[model samples]
Target chain A: MTSLILYTPSGVLAKGGPLKLAAKRLKKLGFDVAIDEAALAKHLRFGGEDDVRLEAIHRVARARPGIALATRGGYGLTRLLDRLDWSLLAASVEAGTRWVGYSDLTALQMGLLAHKKAPTWWGPHACDDFGRDELDEVTPDCFAEAMTGALEAVGFRTESGFDGLDTRGLMWGGNLAMLCSLLGTPHWPKVRGGVLMLEDVGEHPYRVERMLLQLHQAGVLASQKAILLGAFSDWKKSPLDRGYTLKTVVAHLRSLVNVPVLTGFPFGHVPTKVTVPFGVKGHLVVQGRDAFLGWDEDHAHHHPGHDGHGHDHDGHAHHDH
Target chain B: MTSLILYTPSGVLAKGGPLKLAAKRLKKLGFDVAIDEAALAKHLRFGGEDDVRLEAIHRVARARPGIALATRGGYGLTRLLDRLDWSLLAASVEAGTRWVGYSDLTALQMGLLAHKKAPTWWGPHACDDFGRDELDEVTPDCFAEAMTGALEAVGFRTESGFDGLDTRGLMWGGNLAMLCSLLGTPHWPKVRGGVLMLEDVGEHPYRVERMLLQLHQAGVLASQKAILLGAFSDWKKSPLDRGYTLKTVVAHLRSLVNVPVLTGFPFGHVPTKVTVPFGVKGHLVVQGRDAFLGWDEDHAHHHPGHDGHGHDHDGHAHHDH
Candidate 1:
């Protein structure tokens, strides 16, 4: 039984034909899927949306063992989250399941982490899977091995050295905007010594810089061990925008802290994304002669859909988390 | 010398021009004025064209004591703030100078509070004086009294009753856009029991809602005594904008917390703004009756220009804040 459920909030994806087909593809991949249309309908302010969404959650939770996935990404999840019974979902996940998605799906995932320590994955969803054409063998191998817990993630090794080298800590982070909203709240993990990862879409470079500065200024960046820059794809600078550029943001980040700041990774609002298990454990190593992709059973991974996989971890290939 | 300095980082108010003449008018009404084009230049990134604007910070610190005011607002202050000598500025005013202005001026005031505990005022500036063609006497009287410490802020009563309200704290806030940027940053105050005041100009209703949500989600709106929605003057609901309306935003806030939410008041990016003293100890009464404001000062009123007269301590005043 491959554990996977598809949930949609904000109808941005639920009603979209393309998104529906996106779910079918996931179904074809071999996973149980479900969509919380009520959560999606909340945006429309329609009656009975809550009941509809609640039914979807119950179906997924009762699925015995499965990973819950978001159907699509847009805006509206923030509203539904406050009212949802997160603990109920958590109890089901603990029984046997995980959650995944990014983009606006971030609000749900981060909320879970903040509200209940419900472990989740920052990866592709029903509609935005990193296609085979898009990801090479190594990347897929990396994904396959991670879900099945065949590998432990040895975080990024920045090309640039940690300016004031010699520091250690746990790891944490996610979509930039979501992470910013977490600051000052109980949701923000105590990421001291932890590798801090960040990536976002739809924001200009300056807004990105402002957010980074906000984090740094708020004491999060200063507390982290090594800061990792994930995939910031297609995010561009506004033509008339005179604010910070990506390079400038990174440069400024490096200048502000003694910690190592590295880029050229894929863990944000991108197509070829990785399922990063934040707050677990990881190390920041420079991509030198010592750097190579590797994965083991320590980090969890999963096949698309499998009503028959069971609690077995041996089937997952090894690459790196 | 009057300890108030009229500081404008972005917009330049011509000296002896319309703006300076206006300041002279205020000064004639018994208020002291100090305009630092250099500080304003630094604030506006006066890189070259206005090279004289490159005057150093010790100079900014050496301000001729009076409410340090911004000429007009633009956008270069945040950039220059890091280079600002906050300690020196405070040292320059051993007593305390009430910093005032809104919009672009918010960055400076927030920076001051963030860098160190400096009292800042969120209100009108020199240009506002010109707009008071009809309310000239009242404008200059309040401006002079506020600057010279001759004016005593009276009681604050909101039309929205203070019922169910049982709290008191300092009142703080400026522009909504400014608040968004400061989230998760050291620049934000510890809004506990604080009467959270918000205002903005040109922002669409949805944008305002987004910002308010950002504040609420960020946890700033959690424990505040009351949420005060200030003038949304010129605010629009974009023809193409989607999501929540300002009213919905207010309702959403009320739904999330038990705090009293009040609206329809002045104190945004408008002229004739009330000089709000941020960081001072203020009493907030949200009950249906007797909504009072303003902090108590043992010295009450101090003057650098002329006789201190305006004495009213109920904290009530009908001016923008």
Candidate 2:
């Protein structure tokens, strides 16, 4: 097994010793693991130097041609994304190095997708992803497939009795704030006909609705065949927000677009986070309360993890493997 | 002068005694003023039941006949944007009811633009834009011109040595978060070849950068001809992200696309905010230290608000006007 290069662009992992644990865990994965100590220190000290962060990325990508994943999300990658050598990074991606992370890691994911058109995942870090005992198999399978270049299947399945919507296009979107932050810049991708999956954590319903409004006004939400509602974890309401919730946000989305809008996706900042690859062409078909993910119109034999071909009120299509 | 109507969608204003102050100031515009008290109360009390909020908009739109603006930047319009009886609202707009405000007000702007294709401005609100003495002539002029169709003669002067950018399309965009809030929904308008202007207040530079990154990844950022940075007031950094600033964020944009990028344009949560009309085609050119705004490639003028651009090494083509 190759080594894992851990980076903390946001300074989250650096502060609480998440860095040390990350390094040790990756080491157990069977290869030499390294943490960008200087970069971590810089973030821990002064907090925002793209140079240190970039150096870390380059060094890891150069030395270990395997995987580069963020440990936790705080809030610094956006400040450095544009300045990073994206072209070289793109070349590097083509040269075969996988990048991973979620939450604030969305900074890197959005930029990579926009600037380099590189494929990435809307999944979890090693700590949250593999650290759990009851870890969902879907995420791990997807991760393994991507890392090992065995990701041939492109499908998802919904629960029984779930309302289904069918969509065919390249996948786009992840965290709401990350998506909102990229408006009026070169990093937000144009999702004319896309399987736009969205989720959030800790945001009030009104805030989520506002971000969704931005996507619609910017034309990013238009012309899509289906809308996928991913897992929204721990979203809160301010005392002043007057009881609005994500349920209202969902009803609002369904009210606006004729496209089949489905909710209950399990791929976001949750414990059972699924590794969803951005910038890949795929199809989503909703049959009653179930949804099936597939590469084409026929989603017969293949199952999309355990959550396929069922009536999933939560918007996830469960399929029997 | 006509008194302005104060419309509150979130209803938070119902508790504040100053609600009358907003009405009083707009009354100074030499016209009778009124507040949508019922709608304001309902929006704040019941939340997304925008029936009252929409009624407020319609009432002011019908009664005032011009510049139907929002009272504050909170979270209600996204829920109300679609349900607001936009076709009736469009008829009112055609009869000349101009709407304004940034932040959450972006929903109204986008709704008006997408449904009616009306030109809407990123103007100030009751507390900031309307009722303040620090208001400048340039702002009211831009807002006035766009509303009255006198945008041609209300010409903008470029900063000296600011040769300005070269291009054209409708200018669109608003609060970074508000725009992104509308993603995967129907409210976002298609922005193409237009100048994508953005600004925010009290957000981390990294956060701002992430929102921008998200837009780019969603494919929303590529279609714009130029990227305009509006006034970002008091947008500071966390101790965790001390070194990275908005400047670093701009540098990232500069390193990305060849499109003309100009900073320091006035919009967002600032005292001296300018009103930008979305859905209208226009051109934005930035040459060296100066920037120009025009309708198409045919005409080019200096950026209206600055005095001899080049405030810092940051390519901020702004003037005090």
Candidate 3:
């Protein structure tokens, strides 16, 4: 049984019920879940005071559990980025501790990539995805298999125009807003020719377009082989937005950049998100309307000069066809 | 007679009533006001298509109006930054045109600063301010005085802390979100030891803090002389935010950086906003809870190698005490 430690590193966990339920479910899934002492701690809107949360993170990293999962994601990790112990987290990664979560967790994952070239997972949060009244069938299954090294490829149905689109690059990116927030910062990972994945919730289409345009204008899109757009859900349409919609936003983005912008990846602030490795070399292939992102663990382990820490360390490594 | 042009550069003007009313009010304030040809044009949510808006910007620059005021600010100018003719706009600035507006206009203003070292104004829009059903007396008065070079300073009350404090630097910045969007982009203005002013509407405190943290972590705040925070309005309180407020956000920011963070600047998306120069050398003085920002036009005019386009050309020029 793999040991998993659940902690709250971001927003305040309002109630303990969801966390308990999540632990129960994760335990049933053979996670051997152990909740952190400050998992239910609160400081205003954060899980704990800045120092407390920071300590909890270092604690989890020191424990070197098989999985270090966040209870939920709201708005806190960016604050901890400057003071975080990256070496400790990276050492834990070397010890086979798979840090998993998305949303606010993007900050940590991106920081690890920028500082130590370590990989993390873009997957479900404990409270948000696993602690639901009813468990999502695909989320936990995908997460468990990925943790156990049994899952290699994840496929989804994207828009049609990318039928012959076969490309390989470092897989990176998470919540669109979180990614934008790290721009120009020391924690920003300078990954070129990478397949960027992005998703967001509650952001209007115009806001989404603005963020994408920021990435585009900053020349991030041009450096990438492909741009994978996941779910941009929970946005409200304004009365002033006559014909302006997400479709139009995507069309405008496509017109602006030469990079292939593929949509409809199963991820984001949605329930059925796939567990994808954040810093792994991924091979993306498109057949008709179906898209697949696959990675080889053996190749990842043999990365040059890396300690073979369960995932690829070099984001610049090219996959030989 | 000073010539002013009212044009729609960003969001669509759903109704013509506000534009007409704004024009009438500006004319009453003893200026020749001309509404742009496509002031009322609509394309989805923008004032016009990208080319249309871009052409309108160049058109306004060619006209060399005393003031080129945006009709409104929503979400469109970021698209036109790459295509904008910076030299033409700089020539217009040299010819005595004062470009003005806040919110989305921050993109255009910051671009001018980055590309041509030209100054713009962080001021009002047509619809949201002057065209209100009940006009704000202070807003129009400040605009008129700032336009004719009659107003040397604007003062406001702030929390008592920095009495007898005096500092001078280049005055810059506008809407917070717009400023953050330009980070890591070519449009970003690299201003050091400058007074950075910021404000935003409808963004939660946590979001605002995250953006501020991005700036901080990117080494932006550490280089600034002082930070002037204006009104951050219209954000709703969530049940999860027990005691998390803008006050707490400011406190957190102050703890992270040694720079003085002063509040109560009379700007932002409010009715009673003061028109401030965006790229001019400003002298900031504080005495007993009262703060004043003053600029000398003569000093701004004699800048080295600069045509002295009504504002300072160099953001790095230190003010001799």
Candidate 4:
């Protein structure tokens, strides 16, 4: 059977209920899910002390499971970036480990990209998605297909003015605030001509605009092949901001940068989010308002000569990039 | 009489009451204050649109007054940074115009330092300080003294364990968030072996820790002679954090970087604040928990031959460094 480890590399899990619920669900779905012993440890809003979280990450690398999924994402991994063993984590990926999660996981994923060029999944976490009152059909199916190498491309309807637009480059980005925090740091990925996607929660439109402008000033946004905007939810409007909204932010950015910023990217702090293989080479084609991100089936290789598990992989599967 | 221009380069003044209050107070103190016409102009939340604000900056440069005091600092200068004429502002400074303010003004001051090695003041804004119901004696005296070149030194008490510590470097930094926002951007000052002072309002201890760590990871903290921390006020505590306070953050950072972090800086959102000259060569001396920052007379210069405003310039003034 496909084996996965639920690791806590960020904020502490408040209760064990969600984790238990996720493990039961994943097991019922015919996967062996093991929770790291220290996953529930709490220390002042963090998963644990820095050393504890660092140990969890190193543990997953040593185990080299088929999937190493994060238990949750909050704010912790950025503290451990400088001390992480990037090569060991990359070696795990080379041995068929597919690291998965989003939100605060952006730091680790981007750090891996900057340090090792390793591929990671920008997808659902254990508790947030599967542990819900009723698990969403889309998220699980996407996660399962992605983990088993049966998924390739995901499509979404974007705004108009992008018809006949086609570009190909490596896919990277998550949580806008986290991505911008890496700017000018060693953890920042130097991905020129790459498809950059971003999403966030609980940040007002003005703050969002501020961050985007920082990237613009740093020449990061313009360096991208295409800008994919995901969900920016859970932000409250301020009384100070009259007539300014997320739409205004997008319009302002569009006026500044020379890149096509396509909205409606179905990812980030949401229930029905899609799994994205970050740092994987992909093709972006926009036909009118409809866009698809895909990769070549033969070129999208996970690992060579893997000791096959119960997770099935069809080499003939095609992805629309 | 000492002449000052109340310029609104960031947020709108929201009311003319504070401007009038500050102007009256300054005139009573033997100074002539002129309020910028665009100070109250509101374009959404900013004082004006990018071009309008940019024009205001250029106008201030051309009109080189004794002091260019920002009416208030909320958030707007970062937008017009890429388009700012740094040489013009530097020329204005060289002509004896002392640019003053803190918080969001960190961007403008740091940008000037990075681009032209120009000096600016890290101090209170017009509305926040002079417009208050009753002015604190220390604040106005400090401002008056700094502007008149009568104030050569400001002293404060710091924590123990730093007695007998003596170090000297260029004085830099203000408003932690604004400083971090400029990180990885061209505007961020690449100051080496500098005495960096920081303060902020409404940012929790964890957020403060994260920004500090970002600077640390970027090799910023270790390059400093010493880190002078000012007020971190008005942030609410999260129950999720078990006893993790700003003190905890400082202790954690001290363990990571090998730099003396002295607290109790009487600056920031508080009423009783001191004026600091950014980009000035100064000395830091610690004596049994008491510290003083001072500069020399002949070595201290403000733009060559400043036709000397009515503000007193004894030239024999000695600052406590």
Please give the distance, in angstroms, between residue B187's alpha carbon in candidate 1 and its true position after superposition: 5.1
Off by over 4 Å in 3: A299-321, B299-321
What TM-score would every model get versus the actual structure? 0.74, 0.65, 0.94, 0.93
Candidate that beats the other on TM-score, 2 or 3, i.e. the better one: 3
Better of 3 and 4 by lDDT: 3
Which candidate has the highest DockQ of all? 3
lDDT for each of the candidates?
0.56, 0.61, 0.86, 0.84
Candidate No. with top lDDT: 3
Clashing pairs in 3: none
Selected candidate, larger TM-score, 1 vs 3: 3
Q: State the C-alpha RMSD over the true interface residues for candidate 4, after superposing those residues.
A: 1.3
Model 3 chain A is weakest, by summed lDDT over 10 consecutive residues, at A307-316
User: Which sequence of candidate numbers ranks them by DockQ, best first?
Assistant: 3, 4, 1, 2
True contacts kept of each: 0.29, 0.38, 0.90, 0.61
Candidates 1 and 3: which is better by lDDT? 3
Q: After superposition, how far is residue A209 of candidate 1 from its true place, in Å?
A: 2.5
Q: What is the lDDT of residue A172 in candidate 3?
A: 93
Error of 3 at A292 (Å): 0.7
Q: Where does candidate 4 stray beyond 4 Å?
A: A297-321, B297-321
